[model samples]
Target: MAAVRFADGDWAEDAEFAAYGAATPALRALDAETAHDVAVAALALGLGPRRRRRDGEALRVEALGTTFSNPIGLAAGFDKDARAFEALLRVGFGFVEIGSVTPKPQPGNPKPRAFRLREHGAVINRYGFNSQGHESARTRLARRRDAVAAEGDDATAEPRGVLGVNLGKNKLTPEDNAADDYVLGVENIGEFGDYIVVNISSPNTPGLRNLQGRKHLSGLLRKVLDARDKNPGTAKTPVLVKIAPDLTDAALRDIASVVKSEKVDGVIVSNTTIARPDAIKAHAHGDEAGGLSGKPLMEPSTKVLHDLYKLTGGKITLVGCGGIASGEDAYAKIRAGASLVQLYTAFAFEGPPLIPRIKRELEECLARDGFKSVQDAIGAAHRK
Candidate 1:
């Protein structure tokens, strides 16, 4: 089979596209969950794509106390258990956030819970925070850290971009006790992440979204932040919240108020939507019970990001995620107020070639708008 070729030009590593192209057919033949597992396993073995080009200066972003060579990050849910993070970073993501990890291991929902909406460039997943637990993930990260320390370069080596640890509650955990799970995440695995995400918006988890309620969210953030403060290794780690896209205007306002009042470091807008659009409802398994992400998510999620940006007056850092399939889509998120952006479904569908293409297109968009850097473009739409 011929390798997939980029329309614009051949800038990405040829071997990367060749490997993905050869593997795509076989991967697609398997169930979505199994395919993802196979891909992650391949990546974990260091067989993933290698980015042959460096990010241009136009895409650089300085946020969360470090410099992201580019603003595109691999969102959580892709590497739920922390496996393959290093390989993913090497694939050209400016950062990689792994997990929605729980204090204990979970089997997640039953089989066949992940579906690909190919016609819509989307995915529906009810993975329900399937994780091998904090201990498993902690051990993986610890080994990597130890390896670096052994090299005597731990103190001086530039970070391999930013790594974020996303935390979630176990399905069996009651709503009232959810805070304990998150605090446990910080205490156990927080030191490994450059930032921490308290995920309260996954639709698959029963009653998990309820934590987004102002009353509950406020208490949760405070305890999580306190855990960060008390943990010597994580004292300065930035803590963020990931919310759902289906929130009401009032709910967004409440969340904004709570976030500002508590001085949370950032907000990822959003997780996935339970609301099915007409386009999605027409697809096979469109009615499947789970959170919806991908193309249909682009607009609404950015709208929520825009609303939250306005509500918070842009004080809190915001990560734009949902349906970013191209550089134009990513730029839209930045203008809507995301300091950085992430993508998962699109990457899964198109593979590694999409990464360089996005950065290339984003550079064109920035140049077209006369913006010198990603920071200058962020919230530019709001100003106008």
Candidate 2:
């Protein structure tokens, strides 16, 4: 009896030790949206361990004609309001993107639109680009900029980590006038952003994906670029289009042609996906009517990134996103031709702690691969 008791005690200790060693539990606590808010608060308050000891090394990457202290950035949909800029930057991200903010504020889809599939390390969201509108986002960003500037620590302080504003048309906007709505967003919020992303790929928004058709996409890009030109002293806000991963080879080629002809700055290789594969077969919410992110998205999105890289011939910058949860994932995107990478679903599964972890892993990966810097790794896979 004593021997059995001792064995059980030993097993318990091992379990406890393993739990302490793993970083998954804390990351899985908050639900998708709530976890995002909590992370924003933590970053704003500087609550987490400043230096993630586990992160292997540091990497600096440049993209869209701007310099980033590191290659990891917060993808859009994390801070839709632009309210947590300071807090997110404080968390040590290389860049922070806010909004898919529309010209008018709207409550996204009905509740319970976000779901978690823990076993797959995935989330499905049909947020429909719910936003507080450009006016509100612009107002908050303007105030944040003033506060940062007032601190008077311009040199040593972070440049608020390259603010990128993602723009999308309002739900009610017709396809014919989508360009007008996009222009409204560009004209109103262009000055506050380091760059502007034209989002036409969100699966939740009604008929939004239709804008990706070549004719419509070309017109929208032209108008948005023209709007940027009209804004004087507003250093040409590099315009990039965010695309959907479900597009076929022909569709991708058409969009790539539009990007080149319009001279757009870059492409966020993908938004989330509506397709579910065998990998997520056992998940209950697999059929949910929204885009699936996290591990389920990695392969499909990376394939899209590779495709875009080839189609564009590496001319335009590519920001790979979807299902990236670690340094290895980010490294894959970078080597596949992404100039930079962003994350959202991984944060849902790994928590804020994952940021520095990924950065560290990426650095180690660079060293292991004999690349001196992140730029050296870009398209390494495709080059072969």
Candidate 3:
């Protein structure tokens, strides 16, 4: 087989493209948060690897009433405060999910909150939904909305790429009132986003995962969906709830039930895990007090995603995330029943050049499997 090359040359072998591949090592040497900020700034300046955007029917998938250029999306956390989503779109992601934004700005947990398990290609982050709050994020998103609105003569032109706002509760907010924060979030930012995500799965947030309980989840989704509907001028935004990868099958069943009953539009099958693998246990930062993301999470997260598809009988829209390191991984998620897939840890580790590579590999995977469209492959694993 010929050696696959991402850019004009094999980036792994080319010194000219080394800067992109080197971002991981350079980032690992700094405080993880600081390194993240630097990357975000670079993205804003469009200093990362660049590529021509690709669009066509083959790469398109319809879900949430939107046509995604590809099934791969830039997951939440990278653009946590709604900064740099536009730049990300230009990098060729089919969609970009920003924020785990709260009602007010939060400092999050103390420093050393994020760590890289380089040997394992994994990461741990206990950032506690640190955000610039609803108003700050909404302001930036509104500006984006306005800028796009003014871009051409067609004031009502279709959105170029899908945007999802991941909404979370403030750290100090009592679990009893968690629904209020999400309700306010949908009303305030829902209009600006093509979709909204109800995030209640981060291990970093105390008591937040409790919202995943049947009683709490049902109530929360009801209130949040109601808020999404109340937004004026804009159509009802597709609402999704992200769950932790550590959840039990019983709990997943409950979530599928609540999501169906409440009419939630989609589900991001799994978030980072609070668990660690025995294989990576000896690595430094292995026992860090945060959610673990990347390669080690692949099996568990995909299992959850697959089970969620079966539990929901493939009726629920699903977005598979966590441990996606290649196009094959993304394709696996699709076959497991994900209408879409997202990546963040892999993006941080692999850089912008990784995006096009994954897309190309995904298309190849579909063709090899004799699938005419990516959408046709969704849930094929569960056909038996």
Candidate 4:
């Protein structure tokens, strides 16, 4: 773990890159899952070293009725339990998503389910919605909400950073009953989150992806939205659906239609894919039976994001995920049509230093293109 320094500062050029080479490999020496736990613990204790890059006005993005300090957010799987979101925010992410929490606690798939494709800068995991469940997460989230409210504006003024909960049903839940678990999550955790994500895309859970089908999707979203509207004094939280990159174009179009008709707030353009690209074939874990994330997923995922943008005519906000490793990758997503982009594998591989590096490069990319802000860069390629 990096030492905690009270003085806020950015990394020295030589020091940051040296830390990157040492960081991921050191974590990889331990088993994949154990390394993940250690990282999460470091964040919860506020010992995680972050390179704080002050966002230029060009980096701030307004979406979903809130201002994002930057368009880059930490993706869901990184902090699945919501225990360390405040610490993560302090790490300089515009937002940090936690959970995929189910209605009931689950142990998830058997151990050794997470693998590192080091040569390929990717990971394959069949974590199967491993969640601490809704109750535990709700309490944690509610506490953060109450504490932040108590702090009242005296809290750091960084665009009131966003906290999103990505909800998934328990592994034991049958397909037909999945909606029940999702609704249960929204009812229990919605009021505490800036937004809620209906995660029907993870390929690990049996029949979970089936829920993405139009029939299942519409019903599930309607019930979840109804739960939100019925929350007595709670503000209406935006709900988004996460999809897999493996879907066919027809399937993608169907999803876009459901999102539009259901009045969903946004789409998280992809989840990790189950497909193994040929480039990673030589890596021993290349054929691992799990959803894959990292460098190889960049193009396919961005293509889907771009397609979804055109399919929706840029009507819905899109949070692009999968294979984002640098500012250029992030910039590509924005130009492809992502209003916001997410980081997980990049955060894991490059460490916290990557956050500021991305923020700086992204703003530079926007300026180079003659755009005023990240928002102006959204869908730039499509507009061209």
Candidate 5:
């Protein structure tokens, strides 16, 4: 068992966080996916860490018409079925995004699709949107809402964060008619989330990234936005799009154009990269067929975010993702124009302590740069 020492600002002070640290070695003994399953199960049982300290004003962010206590969020794919979002939110994520959920349940690709590149601090996953589908997630969301309602004061009873529902199509859905899947997602679980993400970027899903093309993207967003508008319950919910990191300059520009033209709420700067860096290629699973995420992606993904930020003229909210394992990385994303940031690969590797570490380090960065808050630092690089 790992000794849980109480350092002044370490996450170990939290019993739940310390429990995660103590379990790390054992969890690491299991296969990557199995460990993920166990972690999710544990979180669902309300075993995840809870915040004992309030976020400093420097970490607060106002975006997508809502106020986030902090600017860091857990990206989608961590809780794909929404089984543990409440617990996850309690774990100190400014927000928790669950699902890459399909309209119907899917077993996803064959097993052994998730790989850890420990030496490189990365993961390659081809989960292929394995999901329990819309209904399952909606049921959980409904239950959470009901619980909050039962408490009578949602402001105090609910967790302090946002919930983003990431929507994806079933594998069998054809490319041309993909909008139907996203529209259904909005009509079904849209009202349950603070925001919705149209996840057209997961490389594991066949031809899904093709939707990023300008021609297809405009039509898709139009339909999805229409559904959002028509849904009485979710009419005011913000909708963001998740895009891949592997895009040419022209493609990036085209996506920026589409996003602005369609009036999309925001864009998650990237999902994951399909490229295998030479440094990681020698790893057994480095050449695996899937989206690559973690440290290796920081440079290219941030470059994409910078480009997109310039392309959009900083008009739309951008959620920076991919390769964020430290405060400096998150700060870079923020300076490049991300109003908010998220992570999964790093969290998978470091477990619960990472959340506070990053946030604390981020606050340090903000202070070092002489910025008062995350908002002041956003797009700061562009000013230079």
Candidate 6:
């Protein structure tokens, strides 16, 4: 097979496109709806640079009972249907979490639902968990896994990386029956995922974040754990809860206690934020109605990671998201107690090249900080 060739300056080009592409009048002739279709087409064609591989800087860490080749992961919402898994893995993610998939396919919110805030290097998306749904994802993943297994190579020969599935409640599913939706999602796709993330924090879903409350969280986790326990396998799959960054410290502590008592595998420190920082206040899309994610979210999400680390006393695993654009940002999350880190908006702005850039930067940061490995850097910032 011929090797894929990613365009030169693709990362910078993506940034430029987000900044000025729409202003070209001819391009602006295409509305947001058409623009998205074009972007998806470009991604499907693999339009970015080949990831830079660093053998000496490779990172190994164990979390949720699975070992990851590196600490960086492609956060959910990037490939909502698992469409880009092979390409994404090649781009240097140690793990890839696909979807906030609903039990059934849905068109999601109306057009113009995704807004780019170029000034802040952020995106505001109210996609309402739009997806091709669990069955499609499950079918694709099973095929991929089987193909990998049939290659008959050692673990290293296979992708040998983690795949996480993020599940969400369908729009029509009432909050009262949310657990049923989540359970169905797990039953369908859990077998394919190395781990599963229960995503109840997307601002696009009405009354979703309310599930973060102790009563609902405990009840939901209990059922999901029970399902995992009953699966016909020797190993138990880890279940993680993804939380919003807007939670107060008191709320975070309450959730941490529940996570501990319920034996939840980990917590993704944030989804996205409703709070807009002053730095990006002048941007054109500043008033967009959706969760904001990008550079502005770095400090806030890292703080949340640190607080959760302190609250859980390092017992619960944490996956940090929000504003992680480069290796320094990723290393900061590691030191703040993130066992793994993820990004979405950064990818949207920087393209596939950002993946290797971050890994390279992280290795340099770890060495500069006198840490022998990525794991050694975990919680270093909070310790200070």
Better of 1 and 2 by TM-score: 1
TM-score of each: 0.95, 0.88, 0.92, 0.94, 0.95, 0.89
lDDT by residue for model 3 (1-384), tens: 122235554443244335566655777677778989998987666555534444546678999988897888998999998888887886678899999999999988988798877678789899988899999998889888889777866645434778898999998889999999998888778788888899999999999999999979998888887777766734567889999988877888898889888888899978899887897678778887889999999889999999999888899899999899998999999999999999988888778778877988998998998998898999999876
Which one is best on TM-score? 5
Superposed on all Cα atoms, the candidates' RMSDs to the truth, in angstroms, are: 3.5, 7.5, 4.6, 2.2, 2.9, 4.3
Q: What are the Cα lDDT values of the candidates?
A: 0.90, 0.81, 0.84, 0.85, 0.91, 0.80
User: In candidate 5, which residue pairs get closer than 3 Å at backbone N, Cα or C atoms, i.e. clash?
Assistant: none
Candidate 4: clashing pairs of residues: none
Give per-candidate clash totals.
Answer: 0, 3, 0, 0, 0, 1
lDDT of 4 at 238: 87
lDDT per residue (tens digit) for residues 91-118 in model 6? 6688989888899998889878888776
TM-score of 4: 0.94
* Tens digit per residue, CA lDDT, model 1, 99-119: 989999999999889999998
Candidate 6 or 5, higher TM-score: 5
Summing lDDT over every window of 10 consecutive residues in candidate 6, give the lowest-scoring window.
Answer: 19-28
Count steric clashes of candidate 1: 0
User: Rank by lDDT, descending?
Assistant: 5, 1, 4, 3, 2, 6
On the 0 to 100 scale, the lDDT of residue 316 in model 4 is 97
Give the candidate order by descending TM-score. Answer: 5, 1, 4, 3, 6, 2
